[model samples]
Target: MKELKSEVSGFVVSLEAKAGDEIAAGQVVLLVESMKMEVPVEAQMAGTLEEILVGEGDSVAEGDVVAHVREA
Candidate 1:
């Protein structure tokens, strides 16, 4: 399994992919609000989205593991 980590400290704005969904490299897995801007958290490798560790409106810091992926 690969971990999907947040790139910035922010509040989770939305989830673009759900658990069990197939994901591609660089695809937006979620959106995060930081410094008033929306930043996309992307998958680093193609895989099945295994789990989401954070919900919308949840706070996260940079490098925090937000999700797990079972590599394709």
Candidate 2:
């Protein structure tokens, strides 16, 4: 399993991947709004999305685990 963490402190603006979705390494899984900018959060490795730990509009800090992925 792999963990996807937030790179910035912000509000979750969108979710581009969901649980059970197959994702490739470096694929954008979500966007975070911080400092009035939208920051993309991407998958670190190819895998199946196992869980989404945060939802749209939720606030998250840097290094927070936002999703989990099972190795493909």
Q: For each candidate, give its TM-score against the true structure.
A: 0.96, 0.96
**Which parts of model 2 have CA positions greater than 4 angstroms off?**
none
RMSD to the true structure for each prediction, in A, is 0.6, 0.6
lDDT of candidate 2 vs native? 0.95
Q: Per-residue lDDT tens digits of candidate 1, residues 1-72?
A: 998899899999999999999999999999999999999999999999999999999999999999999999
Point out where model 1 deviates above 4 Å: none
Against the correct fold, how does model 1 do in TM-score?
Answer: 0.96
How much is the lDDT of residue 23 in candidate 2? 95
